[model samples]
Target: MSNHEGTKGNLLAFLPLIVFVVLFIGSGMLTNDFSTMPLNVAILIASAIALLMNRKETFSKKVDVFTKSAGHPNIILMAVIFILAGAFAGVAKGMGAVESTVNLGLSLLPANLLMVGLFVIGCFISISMGTSMGTIVALAPIGVGIAGQTEIPVALAMATIVGGAMFGDNLSMISDTTIAAVRTQHTKMKDKFKVNFLIVLPAALITLVILGVLTRGNAVELAGDYPYDWVKILPYLGVLVAALAGTHVLVVLVGGTIFAGVIGLLDGSYQMSSLLQATAEGIMTMEDLAIVSILIGGIIGIIQYNGGIDYLLRMITRNIKSKKGAEFGIAGLVSAADIATANNTIAIIITGPLAKSIADEYGVDPRKSASLLDTFAGCWQGILPYGAQLLAAAGLAAISPVSIMLYSFYPVLMGICCVIAILIGYPKFKRTDDASASISK
Candidate 1:
């Protein structure tokens, strides 16, 4: 069979991916707990399956393919970023940066704007912290309290928080989802952010308008004090500024961690000893994710070596006759993976290579492909009832995930805007030698 045609002989090449989905999702379905099956373990099992598939190749040769892919520079760099991001988040939260940031945003907004305030704050905190679960945990109780104090539905308040968290998860330079998308697509963070921000900005604004209408006439005399220290928030702001200025991601993360640690020490939030422990704890938190990325890389490497990627690409791009179709295909591919895994970052890591191949083959912009991968994955991950974001928010609010899903407007709108972006070819970029070339100029 010709390489372009991706003949039936390659069909079995997809079995490992299918097995992974079944092991992960199927176990979740049977146990009623997605967490029961760790992602890395599932990927490991699938990697084994992939290794055993191409029997014609010697076992040592197959191991080389797997190890080579796992050890690829991009994969290693992504793992390092994960480590740095974990440290920065841990240090910032340990030093009361999160509390102060949340308090500041809450204190500045009036009672009637509580819902909108939560949304905006969720966006800021998630973008800085780079985790939707963390943002939801930080804000869900407050959202429930707002719902109780006002006429707005509890589900609606929670939805706003989820939506805003997703908004940031898609655009944040520090977000794992964004990191995975950018690295996998070989696009710069700022370039992906520029593309992603334009697509999701309209969704955010429309969500604000919707929340405003819901919050109208729901004003309450807020009864609690929200104390904040301005100095503590500078780490988040500084990191954000540095990222926007296009500083190297490593420098941005390391600077943010150091800045947060210094602030914490100065404020007596923690001593040097405590800061060190916090950083260690933060890095520990990312161990699972780093391992998962490496395993997925190996699994993909083996799959690609066996022609699975070619088969999948052929199946996806078969009907595509234009760049728009290819963009939609990329979006659909990542969205499906997100749905299967219920994890956006993992979905990006899994689909990124194939998406890049599609982009290269179809002339779709890498920035746009990265944006679609993140945005669409965020879209699915945000609304999935079994997904961490809704489950965390629901558990915090003592409500069902479906309740929040009913009002989760931002993700739905984000998906719609992604479709519209493709249809209209919005946020056009130049095709040049440099993938990160300045598109604005």
Candidate 2:
């Protein structure tokens, strides 16, 4: 095909994504009920539109593209994680892990310390697991339950969980964002972690202090009969320990499910079929997310084939002239990709190479560049209503995603920190020396 024809073809491929956003976002606005327009239905319509748009290809070839995108190993792996997460969450709740954990927390913590405690736990779990999604999934239900006991707003509690989750997601060595950043920038994971930790730790500490002071005067009555002992909380501890050890998330979740099941069974709280039923119910709960995942994969695949991403990169970076400009460009690139794709890991993968190029040309540190990619994409993902984290939190809390955004202190702070890092060069490196060393090989 001619170059012009190739460009045109690629542009045509992006129409489906446009359709998806307009249909999903518009329908939600028009109906004034975001849940009224199901995510899966929107994805189905977009995927079908994409399939039809590729009319020039043979039917078999079109099927191959859709199937390949839908069944990509990463996509499949994520689907499996969703399924297992659902099961684990259901079983854990069925066994009273969430109730016990919440009761235990409320018993131990003063009312004023609740939000801070939630934030601290979120950071610990995400740091151990190296994935925000896992941390959010494991903790959100508990957060919701705690909200009911304390009369705390569910959105506020959920925001605390999200903030802590992002804290770990940005700094954890095993996280996909961290791995992608380090690998793309050719930096050691430990080195990048050090830099990331320094930049964001202060913000987290400040947020904790703020939350502590805000809740100091507010106290809630605790139920006398609530389970506040240490033993009933073992399942959460087990999940945290396994995740920190770099166990695969699926494995961590499966282990958690087994532990919860055993605890429930031993306690005579549930029968075997009830346990099985909990697993099935949990898996079924994520049906919307699973469908959204496959549909998004297919739609994005078509967009990639059409050169939409290339166009975006070119358009955004057209004005870069200095290290600071380059840094902002990198942030904008990934943020835009995230807005388009509604997936942070995918955003990083798409923008990483291009970000590397920009960094190399402008003598930006790979470590810093990597940090920017992960941080900004995560920041955007945290606030986006359609993004998995927000959606999952919303689903669990039964609140609007916009309400969650109002209290998402971490992402806002992180974004400010990222921009400040660029301006002040907090993690300053010998750029020329680093560049020479990198080019030497």
Judging by lDDT against the true structure, name the best candidate.
Answer: 2
Candidate 2: RMSD over Cα atoms?
A: 3.7
Global local distance difference test of model 1: 0.78
Query: What does candidate 1's lDDT look like per residue over 180-273, in tens digits?
Result: 9989998899988888888889999999988888787877666788787889878877876776565666887799899999988988999999
CA lDDT of each prediction against the hidden true structure: 0.78, 0.80
lDDT of 2 by residue, 1-441 (tens): 122234333555578887876777787788876667666787788888877865666667666767777777877776777777788888888887888898878878888899999999999889878888888888988898888887678988898899999899988878888898888887878767767777787779887987787667666875476765355578888988888888888889899899989988998878999989998988888766776777677677666655667667777889999989999999999998988777888899888998999999998888778888888988888888667788777665657666787788888888888888788877766445443222210
Give the residue spans of candidate 1 off by over 4 A. 1-9, 110-202, 209-221, 320-412, 418-441
State TM-scores per candidate. Answer: 0.64, 0.89
Task: Give the C-alpha miss distance for residue 57 in model 1, angstroms.
Answer: 2.0
Clashing pairs in 2: 10-306
